[model samples]
Target chain A: MSDHKIDTHKIDTHKIDTHKIDKRDWDAHPPYVYPDYKSTTFRGPTKPLVPIAHTLSELTIPAFGHEQIQEFDNDLTINGRVDGEPQGERIQVSGRVLDEYGRPQIGTLVEIWQANAAGRYIHKTDQHDAPIDPNFFGGGRCVTDENGRYTFLSIKPGAYPWGNHHNAWRPNHIHFSLFGMSFASRLVTQMYFPGDPLLALDPIFNATADKIARESLVSKFSQKYSIPNIALGYEFDIVLRGPAATPMEA
Target chain B: MMSNKLKQTPSQTVGPFFSYALTPEQSGYNLKSIASPDMRADDTPGEHINLSGKIYDGNGEIVSDAMIEIWQTDADGNYLDRDTPPMDGTFTGFGRCDCEIKKEFYFNTVKPGPIEEGHAPHINMIVFMRGMLTHAYTRIYFSDESDANEKDAVFKSVPTERRHTIIANRVEEDNIVTYQFDLHMQGDNETVFFDV
Candidate 1:
């Protein structure tokens, strides 16, 4: 116990070295520049807000199995009209899991989610005029394959209407969520195609300080299709934090 | 790569446009404090992720009152089993860093263990806010422990390059490990959120 004693204020979870290298040199993705902190003091919560882990974080949207959220291959119950054995795409999304130092680590579990061909999520609230394909639930999941590779078969999501405006619509895209083997590895993001014009207007995509990252989600046109005659395909590479660019404490 | 061109060129927006019966505040989705500073524990000394950063809306605002949690293994290639419910020998390696209303997060934890395959133990983190139903996953491992990391089964699973996402250094100051992990709500440096 004496050997593990830690100084609360002395610990610093930043700066892995006095000579920190540019994260990109060792990293595959763009560098991350952080924002300034408003206040750096630990003040008690008005009334300690206990964790509500049961909500969004705990949701197990059920992987929806190996079929379309709406249309199943030949198994499960198809909720919506099956579009003639939809030959959408089995997009291949791959990327390395880098630490803060831009080093590639392994064993990290990666998860992904997205909307169905109809652009509607199986979620109850966001189901715009669009019908919910009790089956087309894109938000389920898929872990990143070895080699940092992750692949899944699902329809390229379409744009749907939103109440945000007189008639707001989201661009065609899929939502992705990832969790490393431990509680320390967690990430959630949406992957999009290249041609959609909504990238500029999408608030979520715009939130990032890096322009390139926002651009990374879009997939390039690929001639190689796991499907027979799919018109479009999406491939987005996500780079997660590798290691301690700095430390994890004060 | 080409798929990215199509989406950004046209710039289609992705979203949860419809308001849920639960308000954003009630939903715990606002980015209040983006930068949370923390302490790192180490013996010999080294560096770590600052464990800071934020989750922002398109508005570029740090969500206020949001919670962040992370779980991981240790430096010896073993898992942390403090929270397990006492059933098996399996080590349920996990940790938590919950910060309300700041895009940035601060953690005071040690480098996780390495597996037999030489893979360094990594940390898994999750983010929760208003109007969102899923949590993300990302791992952080030691930068200097290459020999141990080389054999980690889970570490080698990802591509060689992507593995960089979990590598961190072991800096020492006052006998404590100092590292920082800044999260990105969006963009290339975005925090790694998984679907698992």
Candidate 2:
């Protein structure tokens, strides 16, 4: 027990030599977690409110099978949708999970959720004018293959009206959840399409302060990934924390 | 080798918009998974307990839109790993719950067995809320396990004054054990959240 004892307060957020690379500034891009964003409610307190820094015990080492058990097929439309099919233009989303150094992250978990083609969620709280899809549960899970690549087939989510502003609307996007290797590797983000008119107006997307980091959230169309007469392909690669850490949701 | 020049993507919060798919109960569907907030069996060999608490922000106001996820070993100090199966099929060792209108969340689980020697019984917790871009991690140690808590590696790392934040109050009612632990997101006496 003595060997395991650590003085957590003596530890610095940065310079923690462990499996987790010290990335203290990674919290900057996240809006609600940092005090920089003024427009959002419950923003992190400005003064006299300091968040406790990370310590050794705080870094959870991922257990075996943590990212393995619940893996579904690369195609979400197969087992997730209500009747093996969902209405709307079927699109293929493929990406690689990588570390900040661009090294492949294999056998990692990637979960996703989104709105139906009608821009409405199948939720009791969602009272939007748009209709909910009976077939689209809008959620799926998959694990990165040996090459750190993963793929999902689903309908393109529609832009929906939000109450944030007078008539604010969220841009077309898909929610992504990834647990790369440890608790420090966990990330939840949204993937947006290119050239969306609402991207500029959306507060969440703009919450990221760095222009380059925000642009990374947008997926690009790829001719190589296109399925000829079938679904269009969009490629997005995710990077976990490190020197060039991904600016993730705090 | 590839140049590895592709930039990394930024992250966004799961937000208050995940109930439909992530939490199917709010969507009028019953999808069961390891994320359920209770992992106990009536016939299992251990003390049955209930954990209840409220989530508060820096202003001491309730955080109405919050979620809590807990994981722990079975009653016999055994974790469910790839090679180590549950003592029985009933114990999954994981649970998840979202706070309702009252800004309160609770979990019904058995007292976790120590994961390793010289450690007190504790339940691992992860908290997710609307404003939080990422989840917060903490552990719930049993206040009654004074001896074990004293030598526990994790508990020893916490400052003496702040250690109480993670120790739950044990109470018995109608022959049932319940642990009360309120989580403070910020402010003085804020619950200790780990970066994990």
Candidate 3:
């Protein structure tokens, strides 16, 4: 381990001055208590969320190095192979992680998990009645490059049924978890496939309210990144919250 | 290429299947987890303590699929940033634990110090689970630091009765210190969540 010492006395005064940064775009986010999503009824807090100022605790985050990710970490098609490939329509998902200011967020750790082509998760709790693909573990991780670009080679996830309501089926999607530069920059959201009919009926998808923000969750087909005779490609860029152009009252 | 100003991707539930990916080590995967519950190293200086808690839904059942993450300053009130190297390499001040099998989450880390003069020693926490439409943000303040807690600007913002919900109960057994802080998703004493 390197013996580099931190200067505890010299605090970042700039961060202290910019404590009143912009809050997240609440209009773009789903309300904590969207009644249509049944689970939110019991899980959502009854009181309003307490807004607090940004501090060193929110501005600084743990840095993950490139050494942590493995060769097949981002390739779901190969990571869990068991004598043969997983059965599904093979596809490639690529995107850039950027801040709201359009600046790339380098070295961000991006993680994804999804159901297999049969709409079944590898987890034991999933009782969707669909067959679980033995060769597909349905979990992958990748670190964004200097340009904030990341790609994953995997099978397209299938729509799955849930117990939320009678005959409830979730739109096909891949869960994404990202950790940007700070605690405030951390985000966990699902990426949906464009033009899926189920997106219209999914309560969770509609919870966001805004049409544009809801559409932002869907990834678009990209012929540019698609490999000939191998797999189709989809692009889903993520924009995390950025510091305000002008300070707001704390 | 998209426009410079872009809308953020909306948050979705973590659902019940993240353990295998986010906390792979605990889920029996060969892949290593990016962050673990243990954040302390032998050379790290501080009062080592075990912070453990269970997550409960409105029904009061243990949330087995919940994952809890924590970020805090070191014992000396210094947060880790890329620009400045940490005094202790092993103390990253970040940890992740999922309540999959045990129905509880635990972190073995040193107690964090106050980041500012009026602030109390606290650990920033986030809760992600299957039922939650979006992850919840909260903080863990030490009950022992009542003096600092009384003066904390953030802690003071919470309602008087609800303030106790964010403070962890301290216990010591056989020279080992432990802080117990349970999170209630709804009903009764629901944890005070922050928008920040």
Candidate 4:
């Protein structure tokens, strides 16, 4: 019943529509794990969460050239071959680099580092009692071919122990770094050998909440890739992103 | 939308062990192997500038174990994406550097060209460190390119108040130029990361 009229000039439609322009839908990425995991308690970034903006830079960066890679990086077997042949069960780890839709990610560069069969790294920080192999340098790099396939000849890494918890030991694993088509496409993950008893107890591997996704990190023994009496073969296909993509480290 | 049940694997810190494994170190024969982070040659053309910065965690403490990887187009804004050998040995689009004990990192390269016409001149960056399960992706924008930044589609998308966190401040001395941009993992001045 009042005589005052509503003021149209005071209203701003742009303010109400900001969500459409500002908020992005990140549907494909896996959710970040809960921070309560024992190991994450001390190591995880404790900063308050801040939302990220989806930008064209993430989607449109360049895929690097052959210059990013060098010759003879794929053959870890000989690369580690120095004073004598490395001691351990030899392994031929091979797989295809694929996208979410299973398309080949050709020419992707993959790098790997691991502990030698004696469960000791050449690094000074690795104070494990296991003897370090003088000849095994435990590192290799390779680029995906036209078919998106990459292979490395390395000895299977052995289990090592750390003081993460009382009696805690890490399972045999190899670290992988993949530079995909763009900066956003890069992924780093650890591949573990199947049937390793420490997989269940390792806090890092268990940090992945999904049981099925956690199991995916384990490489399977494949006779098809084995070099008959020369070395054992393991297959570990890596998916860089999307729904079916492999679980990656943050 | 997919179900949120599948959780990502938690990331462990790169630890002190990565010194030889990832960076340039001489403890082992193979450790000296792999890709070197050098991105420029003596004859690479363009303004030679030193890009430097330190990385801070949520507590604002320096993160010495972190490694930064940068990807940028040449001064002409062209990415060397050819399958064949390079026509000119000048441009290598990718480079990486590990942080020192002071939690600082630096890259010696030419200023990148604006990604697209009227876009802000920017460089793509990825961070890998202990604790981060996956690498964090961000971009560095030049503070001097205000006109282009204003029109850049990506820069415009960022909220005006938070955009300053990504801009590198420029300084010139002794006929040399240097740009400094700090990255904050958390807190009020947190850097703006991009989702692909």
Candidate 5:
């Protein structure tokens, strides 16, 4: 057995604020059983979730190193190309990852996957009747720098049809996954393009009841980051859960 | 300085298309996954065991597109910090597995010791799938650790009747130890999910 001692002091510090920790705002998120999203019927849990304290397990997460990410991993336009350049309008997506305290979450990992410009994914499950771009694989990943910022170059994803409703078509969006400082900070969300008319009709996007929270998922078009005649730029910032505020000593 | 105005970025579903990107290996992508089911190296300490389970939806159908990630303390009950080097360089106590192909997820790692007094040895898990808007958080506790589980505060927080939903049954065959723990999203045997 290894002789590593358990850090009792550190464990105690975390236990003190277990009850006083700031709870996540469930009001801002969609309920588990939103009927409009047809799949939720069989997937959403029926029992009330048991609230528990954040133990050592919940406060820690595995660290992802820079070595794991390759040079072309962040450039989807080039990394997945097969024969020639992907046929689509290239765009750049850049943003900063921050905590609730507004502090930069440096060295965090951010991953993105989306349908191709023709609204088709390079997976066996997606049988969308769109032409697959041989050049576009539609996936990329990058680690946050010192300023908690990451960027990816890819084509603008198109809207896709689903069988949710009679004529359900998802809005143009990209799936994003982030690993922040702690397990509580992990987030898997989708970033939607601004000014998509489908935003009003999409059940998944409208799941979040709060108007402001739902709007926050939309990335704003940025001229400063856009390259002339190359790729348009869009900025999407993410805020993770911060450490709970400890009560003052009596 | 903290800003109250800075609300969290709302969550969205991972959708059915995440396999090609997140769990590339399972989906036949040439790229490597950041974390895999193999969490232990050749020399990692403690009793190495395989934890495997299938996730069932409300209809009791297997969730083939779900991704399960687990975080646990090392065998010595030490939660290694990002900066702390382990006794063996490879044991990170983290694992990620996708059920896209096999319809079940499995992880190989050493059984964790208790983190502190009155706590049970357990693995924290998070579930992400295409249908769920947000991920579900759950923990895996050993059925063999009844003494510790009874005393654990977290276990006590769960209703008595529902506490069994979180325990994993242990089975051994030919020197290989495996823990079977299935998760139910709905219906009769729904697993106890926690909000942390």
Candidate 6:
């Protein structure tokens, strides 16, 4: 009903009317729909970390992940802690990209990155770096669409060494990054594996007290999609720091 | 002549940022929210979304398969069923979509209301894979004229230098608020994430 027009020079949203976007799964407990709130905060402008060289003209995509790109609920179902006690294959990652209020502008981009099967990076800065694999190239990136779905395929990384002390090696892990549509949503963090004994010894992994909370990043193995030994699957749901105070995007 | 084997000189994105992990201090933080395996995972309602865009890298190259995630408060500024306000029903707040996908990944969600917290409204976000980290957290806010984005607080606090990453541009034709979040590590402009 508003006079605002959609932005051009980009792909059109709402072009396909048939694709069914996922709905919010409410709690089974007592239902309580709260009152609606209107936000007054104005969106500020953001500059590109770099130049927008990949314009509408040239769009050359690099191959990533496996060939199977499926929906989270349809082909790839996520069974995280929300179900109470993650057992099978579950990864934890939470945060909100909103202000104190719940209103969130749509169309903001988000991305994540991590190590490969060998736990080595393409850079010399990585202290515990290892020999890079010839066939297995790890590392991927994605953006959020209108429905807020971002995805990428990465190899199941192996643990790496850190200190010379006996058994001072670290377990497998991944790094994360966020680009909010608003300053409120911007945030950065990491996901960790669960049930690893190194958690107690590794200083980086033990920065917190809630061991269960840190282990939320570890992905689980689902029998349905689990390949005997081909590959391991994981689903990590992330919540950006939104209108809530102490937003990370800034 | 002796044969020489060459090591694959991965792309520039193969920096230390991609190989980093979360320090223990970040447990309750952004990517560590569902840190515990006992939490419940809700299904983000599916609707219809016509989102489309080209992937790019730090040097501005098209980086395919960049996974993206969007989270926001519902039409009423309240998360879907988060609180048990005696007077209201349930309101759960959670939504996700991977842009690396195609038009099939669409949704028709209502514009959410401002929250009671008295701050500007916002949409929580997360980035999937970019050679950098596992999961990235951030926010998405709208310009003032939009109903759902006005009252957000986190959207206001950002310094002018960091505003663009927060608010998105609205496309009147599609009736959608759009913003492109280009995530970078150790770059000129980096995403601001929580330490949880």
Best by DockQ: 3
lDDT of 6 by residue, B1-196 (tens): 0011111101111123432122111212113221111111233233212222343344544443334444445555544421222123222233343332241122234444555555455555444443432233455565543443444334444555666645544454564443333443223444543211
Give TM-scores for every candidate, taking all chains together and pairing residue i with residue i.
0.43, 0.78, 0.92, 0.81, 0.93, 0.35
Worst 10 residues of 4 chain B by lDDT: B1-10
lDDT score at residue A11, model 3, on the 0-100 scale: 31
Candidate 4 residue pairs that clash: A249-B133, A249-B134, A250-B132, A250-B133, A250-B134, B11-B133, B13-B130, B13-B131, B14-B130
What are the per-residue Cα lDDT tens digits for candidate 1 across B1-196? 1121111111111123211111222233321111122323334122333444455543345654445555444444343332332133222333333444233556655455443443445555555543332233455555676776776555565556455645655566675555554444543333333323
Q: What TM-score does chain B of candidate 2 reach?
A: 0.88
Indicate the residue-level lDDT of B135 in model 1: 33
Docking class of 4: incorrect
Report the first chain's TM-score for all candidates: 0.56, 0.79, 0.89, 0.79, 0.89, 0.48
Q: Encode model 5's per-residue lDDT on A109-224: one tens digit a residue.
A: 99999888899998878899999999999989999999999999999998999999989999999999998888887889999999999999999999999887888899999896
Give per-residue CA lDDT, model 5, range B1-196, as digits (tens): 2223357888888898888888888668877888888889878988899999999999879998899999998888987757564656688888888888778999999999999989999999999997899888999999899999999999999999988889999999999999999999998789999987
Complex DockQ per candidate = 0.04, 0.30, 0.47, 0.19, 0.46, 0.03
Question: On residues B1-196, what C-alpha lDDT tens digit does candidate 3 reach at each position?
Answer: 1132467667888888888889888767767888888889876888999999998888888887889999998888888766665765788899999888778999999999888799899999999887677778899999899999999999999999999999999999999999999999888798999988
Error of 1 at A108 (Å): 2.7
Candidate number with the higher lDDT (4 or 5) = 5
Between candidates 2 and 3, the one scoring higher on lDDT is 3
Which numbered prediction scores highest in lDDT against the true structure?
5
Q: Model 2: per-residue lDDT, tens digit, A77-153?
A: 55456555777887899988876555578877677778888897765567889887777777776767888898888
Q: What CAPRI grade goes to candidate 3?
A: acceptable
Pick out the ten consecutive residues of candidate 3 chain B with the lowest summed lDDT: B1-10
User: How many clashes (backbone N, Cα, C below 3 Å) per candidate?
Assistant: 217, 5, 0, 9, 0, 154
Supply the DockQ value of model 1: 0.04
Model 2, range B23-81, lDDT digits (tens) per residue? 55433454434255556767877888999898878777887676677767778776664
What's model 3's lDDT at B177?
Answer: 96
**How large is the interface RMSD of each prediction?**
15.9, 8.6, 7.3, 11.7, 6.6, 23.0
The superposed Cα distance between candidate 5 and the true structure at residue B143, in angstroms, equals 1.0
Which of candidates 2 and 3 reaches a greater TM-score?
3
